[model samples]
Target: MIRILLVLILLLTPYHPNSITGSKDKLENQISTILSRIPSNTKTGILIYNPLTQDTIYSHNIFSPMIPASVTKVFTTATALSLMGKDYRFSTILFTDDSNIKDGTINGNLFLKGFGNATFSSEDLLHFIFKLKNLGIKEITGNIVGDDSYFDNIYYREDWIPDESANVKLPPISALVLDRNKTVSKRKRGRRTIYITENFKNPPLNIAQKFKQLIEENDISVNGVAKSGITPDNVLEIAESSVAITDLIAMINKHSDNFIAECLFKSIGAFYSGKQSNSFYSQQAIQEFIKKNNIYSINTEIVDGSGISRFDQVTVASVNGVLETMYFDLKNFESFYNSLSYAGVDGTLRNRLTDLPNGFSFRGKTGTLNSVIALTGYLMSDDKDELIITIMFEFSKGSWNFYRDIQDEIIKSLAELKKESSDF
Candidate 1:
């Protein structure tokens, strides 16, 4: 009798995917109503997916081609994580052309050759200088040369606006990046542009100059003027970058560092092709990678790693696919996911979603341009399900605050979503 009762109960519990579907539809409708209040002239693209069930819960204008702004870093970082392992570390080597030395002086020029390490900083330079001092070569007979020959001479994208150079986020793209290719000036009126500078025309030359200063400060004599040059095959490596690739990816995504994104993009091309890095090669590699992942979309376009260019276009569905693929990737998920900005916690999202209710966490990237706004990342809904959400907007006349509010509302609604219960 007990066995019979158990069998009956098991047989009576029917599959209720349709009920869940109905709930999802209702939730989507409610969110759509909120989205409609933003602006009539705005072109929007949105997609929400359940990575666990591998289903798109809600989609609107998912196929529309929209400018993603900095959200394009999602594709850049994801492709990088897939191609380069999370533990990968980019090396910026300090080499000496000649090995012979006497009286603590080098007989040849010092070469600083970078293989696409964007996180290279003043501290790294100082540490390298210390290492040079430890090498018992206090004096250098030749100039300090910065070699970024791993990439092309085109440091700035053709499509980027000339005025955009004033913004630090769009720093010069180079293989050897030091302090993000920007110089810090004394503050005035409590105002200073993060990316603005008096001179950054040549990134390698700028880095070389800074390196020369650090060397001189460290009491290591650099007799020669710093300039951009190439290191010979026969050279002695002095120092390299200590930061891991995951950390660099975090910097790129969390802060939306355009310089790092472009460098990484070019590095991807250089890595795969073993040739000089260029945007065309990077886009080809990204396109091939996108295709290999089966993320097919009619309108997907990528010209630069960072979405600072107005020419970049990507479909909502394609970006969703990219996010879903990265989230589910077993080996690289932690590094990739942790790199995103966590809403109300830190990164670009440090101040957003502060007024949300309990059981909500929006971890993602935020993108903003004069006419574009985008937010894409993960939303942990009530600790029961995880949703991948991407919200993009291209507006003619609307305040960015309004768009951000709408995006936050959408995320809030999704976080509060629940499955319907059946009453038979």
Candidate 2:
């Protein structure tokens, strides 16, 4: 008992209470001053961590649960990396439950089942056909039945810009989908062509050439017109340059590709824990993951992984909860961080931090929809301390100035804090 008391005394002796108190005061003052500086009516929130004082510099509105837009990709990508190993590859398989085979002339229709294989590429597709060929399956006699039953048919978020949604590229979600929900159209320029088929039954280019010839036979010469089209029900042949989801995501973050973002969402369900490979089970899985991980509470309702939904809502506490979960998983932590666009290098941060303070911070993901804007991810101070920051804005009409200025104010303040810490 006496020895314990002695140890406690020694532990307390060197502890500087005033120093700790001073640090708190400094951090609190900094946060308050920064919050006060924001000019807009943006419903904004923030979180900061100071390693020196072991403080979780934080703000409450951070969990205001605003629309995230494509920023929802952050959740999806993170979920994918967590559930499906980073190295896990999605495979597109071709198989039929029949015994008809005769030099590419079978009596039954060909079947194509898609499992949201985001990685499905021309090469992978070719490989699948080769596998089919190896099975002595040469011809399909029946029409292609694209098996998209793997997922529930819940495409399109509750809130989407109608004008943007109408574009076929931004088509509603579907199982057994292909190519950013679009198809390639090719036309021939040379004359002497004939026979064009609207069904695209075979040799599309040849058929296109034939069409041009017919047009010429009609005494009309037009060859340079590119054909406009949607992807075929069954990918008859693989291409050498069709972009896959990996590249899409690469561009998705870099250029903020909304089309690619939505197309890839279906891939999540098809890849894992889905009733059917093409089902939109991603949201359920995410909720379960959140519940199982005990990070966010069960109340967080996520419509689309992307925050394009106006009905989506998350709490500040839950946001922190998710962040806390991320802090421990190092591999996931790294992947999560790396996946975000670098301030100037890529991702949503392209024009953001080019000449700004937080620009040079670690990296982050940005979300925007109509009147909503948000920023989240890691930030580092000059002292080498890493902080997780989540900023969300829900500003009213004529709140643009306030929305931007407030975020900038918050960013500038963090920059100053970083600078101040480095001075020591």
Candidate 3:
């Protein structure tokens, strides 16, 4: 009878070749094999977590500080959404000192005040013009002044590479950005046509100039030239153009737009302090957010919103912390999640991971610099389990493609994981 009982007990136990331990071991071995190919001096940090189970699936140098390139947008966007809310909007207002109009003329200067609307464009200016025409004002007797005092005068971060100044991605940061602070002009030389692209040294002044030209083109007249100055407190508001924070974050995350990212960063500082926004206040705001949420306990430095600054440093653990926190915040999670690029579908990842297995998907942000590459986001499997993964490689001496291949492989391996089975 005892022998019969023992045989029944043995038969009742289920066999799991892909048990938790076995599957975890397999994954670790696969990741280790991939890491072995990296150069000796390279810094690597990776962390994978199952949010539903609150289990850390894997970690490697997770707390080591590494340079994060464009991945910095993840933190910036998350913080902005948490504090500013999805309905927040940046406004550009037009004001005039003279409320009294005689025969469709303004007796005083017209002020174009910017509150760091990075999407402010010529179309918005046209709308302003239309509004002015409807107000029955065809001429301005005073100067068209540009007000950019919402943020500080510093245009570029000190740590940005000077050689990359001409890159469209590195356009000058300003409160009054027009067409993303880029100016393109056509030039003719030796019977051949060439185009010259340049960044505006003074974005506010350029905007004022463009506004003046547009006014003239629309059959209005300006007696004075375009100039930069402060908007008076007593001016009467004429018109306004605004963009929601939701759209701005999409540009920051999906396309990795540096200009918009920086604008939003400064806006965060301005929003909290009600003072002129600068790097000092902006960095303080981010640090306060980190402390309030207990995001990480490791050493990290955030020098700028866009990861273009060489001084920016973060760990995979910190990155994952932000991801997990945003995931649980019910109010803002949807906006935050939708801002990320979808793998194999849209945004920066449109051309990447196109061959992912059926029902496997990744929605995340990609960061890249000369020798740095990072990816962090949510990875969903066929079984409906969601995993947050962060992979960062800094100061690599090998080709970036090599490290990217390793990242893709790790993602593929994790995506193949089954919720109840260890088939991957």
Query: Which 10-residue window of candidate 2 scores lowest in summed lDDT?
Result: 199-208
TM-score, each model? 0.86, 0.67, 0.90
Among these predicted structures, which one has the highest TM-score? 3
Q: What is the C-alpha lDDT of each candidate?
A: 0.81, 0.53, 0.83
| Per-residue lDDT of candidate 1, residues 1-424 (tens digit) | 4324534664686758777777787777889799778768889888888766566778889998888889999889888888888888887899887777545888889989889988888888888888888878788889999999998888777633333432334667888888877787654555654443554679888889999998898888888899999999998776777568798889889998887888899988887688988877788888877998888667998888888777778988888888888866778888998999988888999999876667667789888888789999987645445678999999998889999998988877666554223211
Which candidate should be chosen as best, given lDDT against the real structure? 3
In candidate 3, how many Å is residue 111 off?
1.0
Taking every candidate in turn, the Cα RMSD to the unseen true structure, in Å, is 5.8, 9.5, 7.0
Candidate 2 local lDDT, 94-125, one digit each (tens): 44444545454545434455445433434454
Better of 2 and 3 by lDDT: 3
Where in model 3 is the C-alpha error above 4 Å? 1-18, 101-103, 159-169, 419-424
- Model 1: lDDT of residue 63: 90
Better candidate number, 2 or 3, judged by TM-score:
3
In candidate 1, stretches whose alpha carbon ends up further than 4 angstroms from where it belongs are 1-14, 100-103, 159-169, 184-196, 223-225, 355-357, 382-384, 419-424
> What C-alpha lDDT does candidate 2 achieve relative to the native structure?
0.53
